[model samples]
Target: MQNPAAATSASEFAELPATASHGPLRIEYRWVNETACDAPIAVFLHEGLGSISMWRDWPQALCERLGMRGLVYSRPGYGLSTPRPHDVKWPVDFMTAQARDILPALLDALDIDLPERRSMWLIGHSDGGSITLLYAALHPDALAGAVAIAPHVFVEDISVESIAQTKQLYETTDLRAKLGRYHADVDSAFYGWNDIWLNPAFRDWTITSELAPIRVPLLAVQGHDDNYGTMAQIDTIADCVPHAELVKLDGCGHSPHRDAPQALNEAIAAFVSKQK
Candidate 1:
């Protein structure tokens, strides 16, 4: 059953100043139940190819059920935010950059005082999931807990194969057009992610060692039929994070929120409730 408290209160933009290496960016973001000022905040990190609009109402629904405020935003190059330059290629450590630099900058710009208040909760999907893990690892004390949905801890052969197939689809099918609806510059969003993941050098990327330092509660969810990765991804998270919980959903693939939204929402709400 879906929660009836699902309601988005506002959508806005945060203008981020240019950093040493990158230009200024306008981030499109939305807030759910902003009036719940005393409640813990839950930030939603979209997938690699996703945008603020792409998340639809899932963040609102989840925040409503948890009685928490919600923050959903489009990363640079995705949605209404600043688009990636055409000639620029993302580095192999792009996700790390997001976790280390971009996310913190955004939070600071938004006046989110992480250190003073309780650490915020994070709900991340796909690439966002990996970013969430990296952020939690890098700043173990800045997060209350996290939920990683279909996150990649390490690159797998299947991941490369599926990403390659997506590249073909983007080239040959209406995938580009469909994605364009979500991004101001579709190629920036697509190639930025696709190019890096398919790069040979990225094959060695892994956050397994980084996971050992994470001390917060973590719930790792994955689909049994996920084409992009196997159960090893979440299983490894369990092995590294002490008492990390795992949820394996049957009849789902790559995206549990899309495939099993109700179950995902209920599970997350229950897990978060326990933390409180």
Candidate 2:
């Protein structure tokens, strides 16, 4: 895999030298299969602690399989994008703001045309998956289809416990050094997500009611073995959106794209084909 924002590649860094504006934040993004303009556009949203490099090549593989162009980007405070201010804590509504504000602005900055947006499909994982649900709910007309992999609609005890444990791993182990390969400011990426989830006030966070407005073709997917959350996350999604379909993968952990790529890709391709 090409080192994503790794220390080794000055040429790779040069390729993504420009930044897009999402208000005060400078966002870094990369295009996959840009030449395939005839196909629909697939925009990938990474997990809470993820960046563009963390996604590796799954975006390309899935986009090729579905005959779509892909957009993969690092969120502000992650990857080569603008780092979050050390003193600032992400608000509970941060994911909502991403769906409502930052994503739209990034698309605008990229100058993706309306025709592309009209034929857009969003594929998001973990925290990004929740953001996808929010985007579809808020802008029902904006998407052709959406696939949310391992999304959290509401905070759970297991989720908190896992995140807290991850904090310990980050502090006491080489997790930070490992993640440093993908992000310019690993702490900005890690703490922005960690601080908020572990906050006592954030325990009450849930988008269950907000999910009712999602009118786009939707798929809620999760691995049966996901340690961070239970199947109830997607189960709750199905309850809110009557039309939403669910996929539960066995022998898979949190990262389905890596753990069960063929299964996830096939499910997504089949789901998108029906959209046409």
Evaluated with TM-score, which candidate comes out highest? 1
Residue range 60-121, candidate 2, lDDT tens digits: 88888988788888888899988988998999989998898788877776666666787899
Task: Report the poorest 10 consecutive residues by lDDT, candidate 1.
Answer: 1-10
lDDT of 1 by residue, 1-276 (tens): 112143554557888888875688888888887667667788999998999888888887788789888889999888988888988888888888889888888888888885532458989999999999999899888889999999999999999999999999999999999999988899999998999999999999998988887888899999999999999999999988968999999899998889999988888988888887
lDDT of each: 0.87, 0.87
Best by lDDT: 1
Per-prediction TM-score? 0.94, 0.92
Q: How many backbone clashes does candidate 2 have?
A: 0
List clashing residue pairs in candidate 1: none
Against the correct fold, how does model 1 do in TM-score?
0.94
In candidate 1 the C-alpha lDDT for residue 179 amounts to: 94
Candidate 2 regions with alpha-carbon error over 4 angstroms = 1-23
Question: In terms of TM-score, how similar is model 2 to the real structure?
Answer: 0.92
